[model samples]
Target: MKIFGYQLGGEKRSGSIENPTVPVSAENFMQFFGVQSGNLPSVTIDSALRVPAIAAAVSFLSGSLANLPLHAFKPKGDGSERIKGGIQKLLNEAPNPEWTSFGWRKYFWQQVFTGGRGVSWIERNGATTAAIWPMDPSTTVVKRVNGRRIYVFDGKSEYPASDVIDVPFLLKKDQISVYSPIMLGSKAISLALAMGDYAGGFFAGGGVPPLALSGPLPAGADAIKRAQSDIRRSIDSAKSNDEAIFPIPPGYKLEAVGFDPQKGQMTEARRFQIEEAGRIYSLPPVFLQDYTHGVKANVEQQDLHLVKHVISQWAKALEEELNLKVFGPRSNGRYAEHNLDALMRGDFKTRMDALSRAVNSALRTPNEARNLENLPAMPNGDTLYIQGATVPLGSQPLLQAPPTGKENDKGNENGDGNDSEA
Candidate 1:
């Protein structure tokens, strides 16, 4: 079962010891796994990026958040924001000298997905955040002293917790930093990719049929070996040709060795691997292109589920980290929020219906609705309008009429007079 030098179902061996005097090349390590040396053995960020499912999941999450409007808000009595300006420019335009707002968010989310922790170095000027820069999570280390966490960058420069903004995926007991998903799920991901390689190799060899020899035995061991070699050469030549046909010797017959890919469930196995990788990142099967259990009717619900369960959690983590590091602990009322309206938007008719309800109920102004739709506002768009016929609760109806018989008396008199004249 061994593909590379590494045994498939056997005791594992460490690739290299920590603090080794001699440097080991990546190619040498990769060769230990029966796979080609060109493919690296270790599941580092670079290696994981090669896996399409992992790349897609990371891109979807980071890109989605990066594109969203991240606003800075001051808390109000009604649990709303007063839309402040202090951190607004920093978040919306550029968070640092090097990266735009979108670039910053994308980099942060990429780190979070790959390492389970996103670290950023904050540059502040007298209680105001001037700029920010993302730090390499792989090289950064967290150390605690005097019961306070300290971040050591590249084993050289040291920074206080307040100076660095850290968003962690999942924290372990007594640990200030988060665990890396890539490091934890490396084996599973590597195995899945290895299986993919194996499948590709199987097909690339032209589905060569197995050869069976029967009839009188050759007189000597050399003769039998020669016969077997000839048969293998013939099969190889046939497989290499476009037309997979070959002449068989008098005593040899050939049979197809394996089941069809469908019957053997090879496709299913590959699909399961994709789903499994998606699970490692808490992504939906649909995100990885697995639509076996999906229906068009439920697609929107599935998207909502992804936003609520996956993207929201990451968004909240980033928001809280930014609030704490960028705004400071004393700034209790200020926070960062990602506008998820775009992601949650439904079909045109559904969105219009919802907007209409909001406007009618005074929850939103006409101008606000127009702004959401990116349309020009009218002169009176600021006014909040309710249905004219809508009445207050527990109040008498304004349109109610007097008893029907009494109201019709005047009209009936005119009709009776006209009938007498006729």
Candidate 2:
């Protein structure tokens, strides 16, 4: 089968055909030949990360997700409780002696957010998991062989699908090749890099635009060169001395060339790039330190939106992958979950109030809340308690007794008299 398409070689011409196929590598052919020529700079993973907004989005998302507590648990009684040791230790503490859980997960997700995939091998000793080792995706090849997926490291050693944990930013229909974010947003990233370069070169050159020399008496090439040098010196001298005006060569005219930063609306364009970066990652602009549309309520809502829409989705994806690859499809009562509440926590007072409400409303036991807050359990804190007015679903109200018929009588003498008279 052909790697790219049915025709095979991109530069090959069919004997009966007049044209040749072009490969994707030539996508930036124009830029190479034209020397940029006002076209956007080429975009790569490194260049894309150079964009501040893109860098911030990747860092924030990867770190925020990796820092959350991932717990392993099994169904017990009416609910589930966290279990320690084994996979849990590998997930929450250290994946191996060489890497902490946070560090490993951070690197894994860094690849993912950059529109690549992450893969790790689950090292097992007999029936139990022993360690975890990260694999370099760039050198590893993943493909289906005999209807079974496998990982081939550097095209040398092979590992079964059951042992490798794989996560892709996006899966193609074939489930082998994944889409790269750098490629998807190449145009936008290229423009951002170009703008940054333009701004730097513009300011560094002392705001001098292209100038023309006309009506000069100079005859030789050396003389023309000398005249240009003199003009640059005069401009630099004025700028250094903070003068408003600088002298120009006799009978020569200097006109500012190209668009100024103000005319180009550079500020607004930069802000728009930040928004575009955020959009690429499904991240809200506020998280990228852009507050253009961020009012009080919107900023707060954006926080919620981050956890619910972005972080939660990614967390779930990782959790499911771990559960399947680590424990197998028939997990037999064991699974992994991320403590999303960690991200939802607010200020100290608000957090305390929320914990109190959870305990009082019988949503969570006092012991559970205390455990979340990292406090020691109080005596009998495990007992669930609800408001005094709240009762069992089928039980009568405990707050007020049923009104008696004797008290309801219209002509009761004792009811009409004051208690002090008796």
Candidate 3:
């Protein structure tokens, strides 16, 4: 046998190769396997957005980080001086001409989830950062030359490592960029989405019937053919409305052919898909709307977990990138940080309890606690008030015995003479 000009199970014929080309690309690999090219997985960012699980994960992460306060601070003594004015406006109000801080953060976070890299251009003024603009990940590429990494934007412009703030997710060794979740779990995501589409179509088409007609046909061949055509027409027409009856001729009976949705495990399959997607994003199943195992008590813990594990990582990445590109190395002790208290804020009771403890323990002043709640400060709120009974261990008592009035009276009576006692 001869296969692609090569002998198989036959005497080999030696000949000098006329032409040869290295198969390095995906297309070439597929061609070698006799599979048609250009059939790449259809799991792009836009397509994945159609999945609820992907949408929820992206939203939860981006929204949580973006909505939280991001502040720049300069270390001074025991506290820090918040960098205000233009810098603060750029962070809290607008990061660029087109997008606000929230929008910018959300866009970059989405990029991280979809493409594994979030890149932005740092626009500067004199010695301070003016604005930060996001670059589309699809058009942005990272290249290394002469032991220095360079960022190429849209294949037209090149930016130095210092000018671009790059946050890569799931970074690997000896690699310039990060690994995308969608790319790594494309097969699973695609399968889940495909199943969802199928289920939607199934329900939309009035679902599968309980049973299908089978057995022998009645009378002549023409009658049998007519009966089959009528049955198909009836089935197709009845799909529009489940209440529509499916009529069958005599001598024909319905027989179970397919498993019901419950027995087929459709719901379980969807639940599994949700869990899989959550795992890919490092999110809890509850965040993806899978509340099967969720409880009210654990929900708060889950949120905390989300902050500690998922949101904190992204926040730290953004903070470091901002500190480096926005503030630069010469900034000294200046750095950016996200206030996670916003995410940790629970109900009224929780907030009040935390504030009470903070104030009573002298960790924060009453004015500081009120400021966090956006309330006005009181006259003496600046004073740090702790529990009157709370005292340092191994320290003298703050209270001392009262001065004796008789001692003072004796000093007055005797003048320069010795003191007298009762």
Specify the highest-lDDT model's number: 2
TM-score of each: 0.76, 0.83, 0.78
lDDT values of the candidates?
0.76, 0.83, 0.79
Model 2 Cα displacement at 131 (Å)?
1.3
lDDT of 2 by residue, 1-422 (tens): 34322345544433311123332236645443334444678887888999999999889999999989999998899888788687889999999999999999999999888858888989999878899898888888998999999899888989998898888888889988898776777888888998899888888877764555654542455666677888889878888899988887677767665677888899899889999998888999999999888899999899889988999999999999889988888898899899987774657887888899999999999989999988899999899988998657978755887877666355456577345546
Q: What lDDT is obtained when candidate 1 is compared to the true structure?
A: 0.76
lDDT of 3 at 112: 87
| Candidate 2 global CA lDDT score | 0.83
Backbone clash count for every predicted candidate, in the order shown: 4, 0, 0
TM-score of 2: 0.83
Ranking by TM-score: 2, 3, 1
- As for candidate 1, its clashing pairs are 3-34, 4-33, 4-34, 5-34
Better of 1 and 2 by lDDT: 2
Cα distance off (Å), candidate 1, residue 16: 36
Writing each residue's lDDT as its tens digit, candidate 3 over 189-226 gives 88777777767867875676445545462245466567
Residues 196-313 of candidate 1: C-alpha lDDT, one tens digit per residue:
6667767776643233454454234455566677777886787668445766667655555545666778777877877878778878778778788889867767787888898888
Query: Can you tell me which runs of candidate 2 are displaced by over 4 Å?
Result: 1-37, 216-220, 391-422
